[model samples]
Target chain A: MGTKRTLEVELSTTGLSPDGKPQRVPLVVGGDGGAVALEAPPAMEPEFEGEHMLINIGPQHPATHGVLRLVLELDGETVVRCIPHVGYLHCGFEKIGEYRQYNQIVPWTDREDYLNSIGNNCAFALGAERIFGIEITERCKVLRVIAMELSRIASHLVWLGTTCIDIGAFTPFLWSFQERENIYNLLEGWVGARLTTSATRVGGMAADIPDKWLEGLQGFIRTFPKTIDECERMLTKNAIWVGRTVGLGVMSPVEAVNYGLSGPMVRASGVAYDVRKDFPYLDYETYDFDVPVGSAGDVYDRFLVRVEEMRQSIRILDQAVKRLPDGPVNVDDVRIILPPKSKATSEMESMIHHFKNVMEGPRPPAGECYVAVESPKGEKGYYMVSDGTSKPSRWRIRPPSFVNLSAIPKMVEGHLLSDVIAINASIDIVMGEIDR
Target chain B: MSPSFTIVHPGTGSNATPVTPKNVPVSGGPVSPTAEAVGAQFPGVISRTVVSRGETTIIVDGARVHDVILWLHDDAQQSYDYLSDVTAVEHRDLSLPLEVVWHLRSLRYRRFIRVKVLIAKGAPLEVPSVMDIYKGADWLERECYDMFGVKFAGHPDLRRILMWEQYKEGFPLRKDFPLRGRFSRSEQLKNALAANPEARYSMEELSIADAFEELPLDMRRRLSEGEKVGE
Candidate 1:
C-alpha cells in the first residue's frame, strides 16, 4: 500500500497578488478522506480574473441532467475549453452483470436507462436470446415492439418537458408530464413497476399484458398528438426558444458520425441511422414508419427530430396495437420461460420445471452477440459474452448517453455559458445510462 | 396486416419455429465481405475470424492491432469509419489473460466488424490507444484502464475516470476480483467523515455502500476470503 507523504509543488492556479504579479504557493496533497490539494504543473497556467476564470458546474446542477460535473475554462463569456467529469453515479454495472444469470440481468438493464426500461430490457433480452438461438413467438415479438415504442414515448416526454424547463419555459413541463403519466398508468398495470419496469424476460415478457391495457394505450396515442401540437404552439416558433437553441450546439454530419453520436443526435446531422430502421430488430422491419432526419445538426434540429420521432413512434404503436395477437406472451419453453400457472397447479412435471427454471436459470450456449435496440435515446447495445453456464462471462452495455455525452466538449468549446445548458438538454442524456 | 408477418405457432420452446420466413440476419451482409477483405489485406496480422450469431469477430495479433485498425480507417475501399465501442474481456484460464475488443462500423457499407487484441497475462496489461483514429475513444479507453487496469500506451490524460482520484484498490473488473470487494473502507470513511464535518459529500459512494451491505454478509465474507461461491 502507498504511504502518505507531504510534497510541495509549483502553483499555477493560485491567482496573482493585489499588485498583479505571479505568486508561488505550497499545496499539501493527502488522504484519510479530504479535499484534493492541487499545485498545477509548470505547463498549466492558473485562471486570472481579467484573463480567464475556471468554473465547476454540477456534480449537482439541474441542467447537467445528473451527477455530471464539468470543469469549464471560461475566457470572459465564451468557453475556452470544457472538460466533463462523469462516473459520479458509477455502480460497476458491467461487473455486476457478469455475476448475474441471464434472466437476472433484466432488472439491472432497466436501471441503466430508467426512463426507457423496456427498451433497455429489449436490448439485453434480444442479445441473450440470440446467443441462445431462440426466436420468440410472433405475439411476443409484437408485444416487445409495443413495449419498446411505449418506452420511447415515455422517455421522449421527459426529455421534452425537462429540456423546456432547462431553456426557461415552464408551461410545457406540466403538459409533458401529463402525457408521460398516462403512459406510466398503463405500464404500471402491465409491467408492475412504474420507473424501473423490468418489463421483458429473456425469452418474452415477465407477464402477459393486463386486460384493457391496449385500450389505455389506444386512448393515449390518439390524444398524444394533440399534446405534441400544444407543445409546438408553446415553443416551436417562439422567439425566445429559437434564439436560445436554433444555432446552438452545432455538430456537422461527419463530426456526428466520427464522434459516434447516434439516435436523433446523428439524425439531426442529416444521417438517418436508426437501429430500428438500419439494423432492424424485434420485427421493426415489418412495421411501416419513417426515420425522421434533420439537415442542420443544431440544438433546434435535435428538438424537431425528437418531436418528429414521437409522431413516428405513435405510428408504430398504431400498427403494433392493431396487430396484437392472441397467443402465448412468454415463450412456452419449459427450460427457458416458466411454465403456465394452469400447468404448474395441475401437472407435477410442470411444477418441477418451474421450480428448476426459477431456482437455477437459462444456461444459454457458449457464445457472444452484440444486440442493439433503437431506444428513445439512441442505439442501446448490449454486448454479452456467455460461457456455457447460467451466468454471463461478460456483460457490456454500450449506453447511447455515455457515448453521446462524450461529444459535448466539442459542441460547447466556443459557445457562450448560457447556451451550454440548452445544448446539454438537446443531447437528452440520462446519467444512469451514462454512468453505468 | 401482411400474411407473412403471422407466424404459425407450431409448438412451444425447442419445437417452436416462426411460421413466416425466419428473422435470420442477412449472412452475406457487408461484414462477411469486409472480414474476407481484412484477412486478405493483412494475412499475418489476422489470426482467426469467427462469423457467428450474425456478428463478425476477427482476432488479430495484439502487437499489430494499431496497424490493422489504422489500415481499416485509412484504406479507401475497406474504410471503417465509426469506432462503435472499445471493450476488453478477462479470462483467467486462458493463456492470454485479456482481450481488447473493438467494434468498428463502416457507415458506407452499413455493417459492423469486430477487431480484437489479446494481451498476455502480466502486470502491465497494456494495448495501443486508437484515440487518433476515433476521437470518441478518449473516454472509452480511459474507462477500460479504470475498470480492467489495462493501460493504453499512448492515451493522454490516462487518469482514473470512474473511480475517485485517490482510489488505490485493485481493478474491480478483473476475473479474480471478488464481487464483494476484499477491502471494506466503510468504517474508515464513516470515522473520517465524523472527524471532518466539512468533508465533501459523495451520495453516489454512500449509495454503493448501501447496496454492498444488502448482499448476504456471510457469503460476502467467504467470497472476500477467496472462496468460490458456486460452480
Candidate 2:
C-alpha cells in the first residue's frame, strides 16, 4: 500500500502542544496517504569582501578650512567611519581666563570665534552680568543686539565667501568680502579694532556708538539684505550648486539632537532650538526676528538656513537702530563695570570708584552659571564658576564650533570622500573654537 | 561735638548689653534648598558651603571626588550629563602641586556643579576618568593631563596639545615654566631642522641666497667681494 504512511505537519504556537493534542498533524498525499520530504533553508554569506581602508584627510589640506585632520575608514570611496582629530589649534582660552580679569577676557573671546567677535563678546558679557547679578540698561541691550546682529552678517558673509570658494565659485568670495568690509569699517569706527573689538564690557559697552558709526550701520543694514539676495540668486537656484549640496550629508532631527547639534545644524534638521528664544538673555526677547528652519537636514538646508539667518540679523539690526535709546549705556554699578576715563580723570569720587573697581575687581559671588547665546556658528556659552574672587575659579566655554564639529563623523560617514570637503564647508567650523 | 567721646560704665567690670537692631534678619534667609540638599546627601564630604552673589558653591573633599562625580552623574536628582571642562591650577609652594577642577552641567535642570580634586606633587598622581560616562570629557581630561601632568586613569590617549613636539620633561603652563624662549640660537636652529626637514638649508646658505635674490647686479658683486674680504 505504498508504505501506507501518513505525512506529518507541525502546528505550534508556543513551540509546544496542549495535553491530548498531537505535536504533529497528519497530511495526505495526492490520492493516497504518504510522507513527503521538505527542503531546508539556504545558508547566508557576506555579499562583499575586503577590509575598509583608513585615510587621513587633513592636518594641512585646502578643504579642511582650518588645521583639522579627519581620520576616515573608507570602503572604496564611500566613508565607513570618521574620527575628527582636534587640538591642532588648541589655545587654552579657559586656562588663560583664570589668569586674566573679567574684562580682560573679552578680547580672548573675540579670538575664540574670530568671525563672530561681537557675538562672543555678548556671550561673555551676558555671563558676567549673570554672575554679577546686575541688570543691563535699555540702551546697552539695544547696542549689544545691534552689534551682535551686524557681526552675524559679517560672519555669514565670510562663511558664504569661503564656502563658495570651497565649491569652486570664486566670484561670490569677492562680492561677499566687499559687503563684509563695510561692516568691518562700521565696527572699526565704534570699537577702534576691526577683528578683535573687545567692545562689550561686563556691565555694558566700552564706548557708546559714535553718531557717524550709527549712520554707517543704519545705511549698511538697509543695503545688506539686497546683497544677501544677490548672493542667494546666484547660488540658490543654480542646478550645479543644488546638485552638490541638496541631498548630501543628510542628518535627521533625532540624530542631530542626540549628537548635541545646535544653531543652523539643528535648525536645518527642522528643530526650532534657538538660544535667543529658549534662554533669552541681554534683552533678546524684545528683538523682532524669525528663526529660520528647514525640512531636510542637508548641506543645502544648512546653507539656506544661514543665509536666511543673515536676513533675520539684518532685521534685528534695523529694529535695534530704531529703538536705541539715548542715555547712559552702562549701569550705575561701579563695582562690576569700569568708570569712564573722562570721569576718572575729572571727578575725585569717580577716581576713587575706578581705583576700587580696578583694585578689587568684580567679586562675583561663589556660584556657577552657564550663559549661552546664538553665535553665528551655533550656541556659544560661557560656563563661569566663581569662588567669590576677582578671577573665576573655573572658566569653561561651550563653543558651538567644538560641539557642531563633533557631528562630523555622523554627517560624513556613508558619503563619498570628495563630498567630505563640501560637508566640512557646510558646518563652517573654526578650529580656534574647536581646539579651545 | 568732639570727634572722640569717652564712656563711663555703671558696673565695676563694665558688663553692658550690645546695642542690636530688632529689624535685622539673620542667617541670609534659610539656605538654598538645592545647596542644603547637596550638603545633606554628601554628609561631611563638603568642607564649606558658600552662598553669596546669588551663586551657591559647595567645596567637596578631593579624595572623594570620583564618588561625588558618580553620584552627581548617576543620581536621578542630579543628572549632570555634560562635562563642560576640566582645568587645573598649580600652586608650587603649597602642599598640593595641582588643584584639578571639573565643571559639569545638567541640560535637563539647567544647573551647574564644580568638583575639584587636589593632587600633591609627585609622580603617579591619578584622577578617575569620567570619559566612561560623558565622551566630551575625553579631550578635557587629555588637556588637563597635558597641561598639569595630572594623570587621568583610563584616558584613551593623554598627550600634550599646545606645546611644541620637543617640549618634553616640563609643563609649560605651570607657573614655574619660563615664559621666554629657553633654547639657544643653535639649539633653536637644530630643533627647527628636526621639526621640518624641508627647511634643511643652513643660515649661511639662506643668507647667500637672500643676498643674490635681493641685491641688484652691481650690489651683488660688491656684497660677494665684501663677504670674501670678511672671510
Candidate 3:
C-alpha cells in the first residue's frame, strides 16, 4: 500500500472566512481523505512568531478619499484583520456651533459634508425651524426639494465618477464631471456659491431661483441620463469591474441595519427604509420618485444602487420643476427671515431687525429638535438644543460618513489588501463629515 | 388668546424659543412600549422621561447605563436599533456641570428618543462603554471622550481622536479651554517634524491643515523648554 499521501488545497472558505466569523471546521481536505490542520500551505504566507505583518495606510493616501488612516494586519496578500483609525480630520464642528448664532452656523454645516453642502444646510434649517416652530411657505418647500435633489444628482455623479477611477478605470471621471459642472453652474446661478452653497435658510431660502436657472436645469435633465448610460456602458458588465467589486464588501440586511446604514448604504443591503418616505420631512412625500433598494449588499450592488439613485433624483427634479410654485421664497415674518434691502433702507424697525439679525442672530425658542434628511451619502441629521439663547447650547450633527465608515473593518476583513481600496471607495466616505 | 401665543412661551417674548408643549406623557403611556419595556425590564435605569415636540428625552441613571442600553437593544418590538449620535454638553451654567446625551432611533417602532446622563459633580469623566451592544458606538464614545475628556470604561481603544496622540494640556471642546489653544500648535508641529523626520503628508490629505483653523488659539504662545508633551 502506498504511504498515506497528503495534498494541499486552498479552501477559499478555509483559513479565512469573510465577515470575520470564526471558522469552526478548518479540516476541509481534498480528494485524499487525510485529516488536515487549520494551517495554510508553504505558498501561503508563513505565520512567523504567531504574528501577521502590519501595514498602515493613509492619513494622507489619495485612495482613502480623505485623511482616513487604516492599520491593516496581513497574512501575505490576504488581510487577516483591518483596524480603521479615524479622527485625522476632526474639526470640533459640534463644539464650534455653540459659539456661533443659529443662522450664523449655516456656512459651517456646509463644510461638514462638502459634497452635499446644500443637503446639510437644508437638514440644519429643518431642525432649526422645528425648534423655532416656523412654518415655511409652499414655494419654499418646492424649492428645497429642487435644491436637495439637484445636490443628490451632483453628489452621486462625483461618487460614481471618482469610485470608477478608484477601481482603476479613468475615463468615467471626466464624463462624470461634465454633468456635475452643469449642476454646479445651476447652483452658482441660484445661490452665488457652488461647492459650499449655504443655499437654504432657517425659515426659507437665500433668494428665489435666479432668472433662468430653471431653463438650465431642464437642459441638464434631458441630457443627464446619457451620462448615466455612459457610466453603465463603461462598468456595468465589464469583467474587470464586476470581478473586482461583485460579491465583495457584502453586508447582510440585519448587519446593515445594526450598523445604522442609511441612504445608499442600507438601500444596497435591501432595507427600503428612507428618511424621506419613513420620516417625511420637507414635502418629500409629495415628490414621485421611488427608493432604489438592492438584494445583495456587495460593492457592485452599492454601485448599482447609486447609479439607480441618480435616475430617481432626475425623476424628482423633473416633477419638482413641473410643479414649481411661484411665491415669496422667504417668509414675510421679519423676526426669523431677514428684511429685504428695500425694506431695510426705508424703515427704522426693519433696519434695526436687520442689524440685530446679522449681529446677534436669530434667538430661536429654547428646545431641542433632531431633524434627519436623506442626504446622498446617508441620513444626515442635525440635533440642535436651544437654551432660549441666540447661540445654540448644543449643535450636534449626525454625519452618515462617520457612521458608514465605521462598518469598513467588518467589510474588508478576510479580503485581499487590494480590495481595501475597492471596499473603501464603495462606502463613499467624506472625511470632512467624518472628522466633524 | 391666540394659538401662536399658546405655542411660544409668553415669558421668552419676541425671541420665544419654539415650545413643543412644556411636557407630554412619555415615561408611561399605553402608546409605544419602549419606555414601558425599559422601565419594567431594567428598573431604576431610567429616572426621568420628558416628552416634547413629539419627541422623548429620557434621563437615565449613569451607573446602570450599559445595562440600560443593552436591554433597550436586545428587547423585541421596541429595540432602539440605531445609535444615532453620542455627545457631551458642558452645562456649566446649569447646576449639573457636565451632561452626556445619546440619540437613539428604532427602525421597528419607527420612533426616536434622546437619552441623557448627568455626570455628578466631582465624579471622574467616565461612562461605561456601550460598544458590545452597538458596535457603531465605538468611535462615537471615543469622540465624546476626545472632545469632553470623558472616559469610556471597557472601550477597546480610547485616546485623543481629533487631537494628536501626544497632545496634552486639556480638551479643546471644554468651555474652560481658550478658543486659541493653550499650546502653540505650530511649535508642536515643528517638534513633531523634528521627532519623526520621515513623516510626510500631502496638505490636501493632511488633517493638520484643517487643525490650524481648529487650533488657532493664542497664535503668539511659544513653547517653553520646561513644558513637556508625551512624558
**TM-score of every model versus the real structure:** 0.82, 0.71, 0.82
Q: Return the number of clashes found in candidate 3.
A: 5
Better of 2 and 3 by DockQ: 3
Residue pairs that clash (backbone atoms under 3 angstroms), model 1: none
Candidate 1 accuracy as lDDT: 0.77
Candidates ranked by lDDT, best first? 1, 3, 2
Write the residue-wise lDDT of candidate 2 on A1-436 in tens digits. 0001112222211123567654533222232222322221111232587555556677888789788877676676777677666666766677678767788889899898888888789879988877766778889888888888888889889999999988888777998999999988988898899998899888899888887777888788888878888887668755446656755676666566545567898788776667676546666766778888877677877898999999898888888888888899888887776777999999998899899888777787656666668888877778776766888855778777776776787777667787788999999888888777
DockQ of 1: 0.16
Q: Candidate 3 chain A: minimum summed lDDT over ten consecutive residues — where? A: A1-10
**Model 3 Cα shift for residue B52 (angstroms):** 3.1
Candidate 3: tens digits of C-alpha lDDT, residues B48-109:
77654557777788888778887777777566777888888875365655888888877665
Summarize candidate 1's per-residue lDDT along A274-326 as a digit string, tens digits. 77765678778778898888765778779989999999999999999999899
Name the docking class for model 3: incorrect
Off by over 4 Å in 2: A1-56, A71-75, A80-83, A250-255, A333-369, A385-394, B1-128, B150-231
lDDT for every model? 0.77, 0.69, 0.75
* Candidate 3, A19-129: lDDT as tens digits: 787663333333322322211112234566443555668878889998888877677777766767677666777778888887778999899889888878878888888
